[model samples]
Target: MDIFTLTIIVSIVIYIFIGNYAGRSVKQIDDYFVAGRQAPTLLIVGTLVASVMSSTVFLAESAFTYDGQMGPFVLFPQMGTVGYIYGALFFGRYLRRSRTTTVAAFFGERFNSHRVQQAAGLSIIVALGGYLLVVTQGAAILLSDLTALTYTQSLLIAWLSYTAFTLYSGSKGVLLTDTLMFLLFMVATLLFTFYLVSDLGGISAAIQGLSQLEHKADIASWHGVIGAGTEFPTAMDYLIWAIIIDISWGIVFAVSPWQSSRHLMAKNEHVVLRASIYACIAAGVLQVLIYGIGGFINLANPDITPSESAIIWAAKNMVPEFLGALLLAGIMAAALSSASTFLSLVGFSASNDIVRPSSPKKTLNLRATRWIMLAIGLLVLGASLFLPPSIFWLTYFVGTVFASSWGPVAFMCIWSKTITASGAFWGMISGFFLNVIPTALQYLELIDLPSYMDPILIGAACSLVVTVLVSRCGHVSRQEKVYRMRLHRTPAGERDLKQTKISVIAPAILALYGCVMAYLMVTFYVTPYQTASGQLLPNGQVDWATGEAFLSVSWALLYIPLALLTYILIWRSYSPGAKNIEQAQTKA
Candidate 1:
């Protein structure tokens, strides 16, 4: 086998071995489902970032940048990163306090209702099953490219590789292997980014060069390359579309099963908080660089077919052989990490919440979970084969499903004293169907909705309305009231004043970094554009009016406010003098 195929094969073998090694320690249901609830910040952060940075990031998103939609693409993930902070403050710590193995179980216990738990579980399987299918197709495509095999043959190989380990080790294996894979891909990404930037004559030259290219005019602008036949026909159109979908993605990061479940694996609420801070930084930086790489790949070869394979193609042709193989392996690592997480959660929920809820047999529960995972694996494999691959759109569609269905309910279930179990259940169902039905119909070409009436926006609004209206009809139970109050109680052991102070420092530093980034943009991007007032456009003449209009409303100005707001919010919630900390310490 050539280096590409050989590298992927060896990587698969290593992943399987690591999964087996981690599996040896799984003795009970907790060990299998939540890593015995003892994962540290690094491991939790690894899993949190790795689990979400799958083929969706490496392939689907990269394609958007490659196709010159970098402006909207970048905005979405930056907003999503803030969800880590939101989740840490409002949702994650409460989930940990509930001491539940699954996110659905947390809902079940919080509401003191088994039906709500099953509803939540059913949503997980449906949403994440579709997500798993997309991730699988991503890996299959990568495998097919490297080995020159048919899509079906590559699909089986990719499926079996992730399934073998996920089936054997469960959460424990997924967490450990996810961390290892995270380290591998992160290193590879940094190296590849550095080489690509250098090859394109550095960032300054690349930006300048991209600006002068006629066919890709306005590519480096905030709206991307908007015009006839483009994704966004005007700057306002791009802005409206990006903001709605971007906020939905932010909700996904905050409340989605795959993302928030990592908090359930954390050793403590502190670990959850710290991991979110770290994950926010890591994910933001990694995605920004990946989008840049995607755009940079276009500078090298603009004719990449399917567009999703731009990164894979660039790896083979743009870099050295060893580095090329490493980039391919990194992409595969990203895909596998997310696949294992999604598949493991699906199996965990299916057995723990659906097939037989409240099983007293811990050993039996563990055994049955593995079998269910295998069954889910086969089902996803079969479905992936039939689904025509629209990698980016499929991922975007499935991912945002949670933003509407689970987002409102997830937070309200934690903070709203008036939200009843009946409300929560119906809210999830309403948000789910309302979002899915319209989006699917639009996908089928039956109807067309304007950008403002996007399915996610409408569905999220429906969920919130239904939840509040339905909540008024029911009474909050004593158990539910007590559970909600209990979630707010700060445990004595978490009261490390020094650590809390240190944690507060991170947000402050992030705020400072945001200012610095904004300054860098003004210096490198804005100043250059301003100086190019006389630079010829595609028509071989300057359009000073349009350029001046863009400069008046630069995206850079939004950074400082967003960053400072994040810091203020984090400080109020996380400072040592915060109500929870002060109240608990005084009692102590």
Candidate 2:
């Protein structure tokens, strides 16, 4: 066998071994669902970053960067950095304090309704189904490109590797394996980036080459706008849509089940808080380097198609054989980490929220969870194998669903007390349908909508509006209101609630960052620099050299420092002394 196959096999074997070993520690439902709530800061950080990055970072985002330009690539990580900070401030401590095994369970408990919990679970299953399918398909495409295996065969192998480990180790196995894989993936990504830059004769040469392209202004600018009749019909549409997408994605990143689950599993609330900082640092650094490689590759060879396997194409053609294999392994690791986490989450929701809520025996619940995980793994695998590749659109659809359906209700539950159970439930239902139905109709060619009307924005707005209006119309029972008031308080008093530094500062920081990003984007729109016409007389154009300088200086002076400040604030505010009220209730 070639070194590539041998290396991949060895990595898969190690994953399975670690998973099986971790499985031996599973003694009850809790152990399987939340890793006994004992995960440390590093493990939580690693798993969260690994799961969030997924194959999208290596496959889909790379392709988008190559096809569209560096504008979105630079914007992507900035959104995540803000999202992590938002999550740390708004959800991290509260989720840990809630002590629920899943976000669905938290909804159930907070609202005092099993139906809401089940609804949330079903939504998660649907959204994650699309997400897992995309990741699995990306991995399969990479493998198929490298070897003689067909797509189906490659998919089956990917399925078996993740399913076996998930069935054996559950969340513990997923966490441990994810940490190890994250280290490997990061190192491999950095090495790949280095090789790509060197092959292009260093960063300066790469930037110079990009500047000489016909669409150099668009490629280098944050708004990706070019001459009067460029890709976007109007420059404002591009700018507005770009900002909306970034903000929507950031909100989803903050509150998604995959991320909240990590918070639930941490050793303590402090770990959860601190891990967000680490995750932001890891995600920010890696995204800039890896996506930079993608943009550079497109500049070097515009002939390369921006397919789902674009990064793999870069790996095979730009790097040495051994390095290429290692890079492939890293991509595999990215897929496996995300697939395992999502699979385990589906399993946990199925058993704990849907099934075990009937109060089944611990042994029966544990056994059922494992079986459920296997079933979900197989189901998603089958779907991926049969489905046409739609990684980019599917990712957008799923992200919108999760963000629109869950974001408003989740924020209300954690921060407010006025929302009734009925309001939350109906809000989710309305948001989900409103968001999905329009997109589905559009996809089926039954409806034609204007390009500017983003379903995600409309749905999220409707969800928030419905939640507020319905909540005011409905009233919570006195007992439920009392329960909510109690939930809001802590042993350290209301000061503990008020002491969240992130909550106080993040909004201001987010606004400032958004303003700065908008300014940079506006500069792109007005700038008249175009290699197509080579027109220096327009005065509206900013030359490629000037654009590149602005981008470098803004990224250095504005984006990086803001990200670092957010991290430092989160670290400084982490309080180990804060107590978990829900854990106290459990012990009692």
lDDT of 1 by residue, 1-588 (tens): 899899888998999999998999999988998999999999999999999999889998888888887644543337677788778777887788778889998888889888888988999999899999999999998898788799999999999989999999988899988998889888889999899889988876776766665666766666788879886767887778887877888899888999999988899877888788788788877887898788878788888998888998899899998898987898899999999999999998888777543555533467767888899999999999998777888888999999999999999987687999999999999999999999999999899887889999989999999999999999999999878777877766666667676666666666665555555555555445544434445675334455433442343354456556555654555555566642353234
Q: Report lDDT (Cα) of residue 419, candidate 2.
A: 88
On TM-score, the candidate that comes out on top is 1
Candidate 1 clash total? 0
Overall lDDT per candidate, in order of appearance: 0.82, 0.73
Candidate 2's C-alpha runs over 4 A off are: 75-77, 215-217, 225-231, 359-364, 448-452, 490-588
Model 1 worst lDDT run, 10 consecutive residues: 547-556
Model 2 poorest ten-residue lDDT run: 524-533
TM, every model? 0.92, 0.85
TM match of model 2 to true structure: 0.85
- Report the CA-based lDDT of candidate 2 relative to the real structure: 0.73
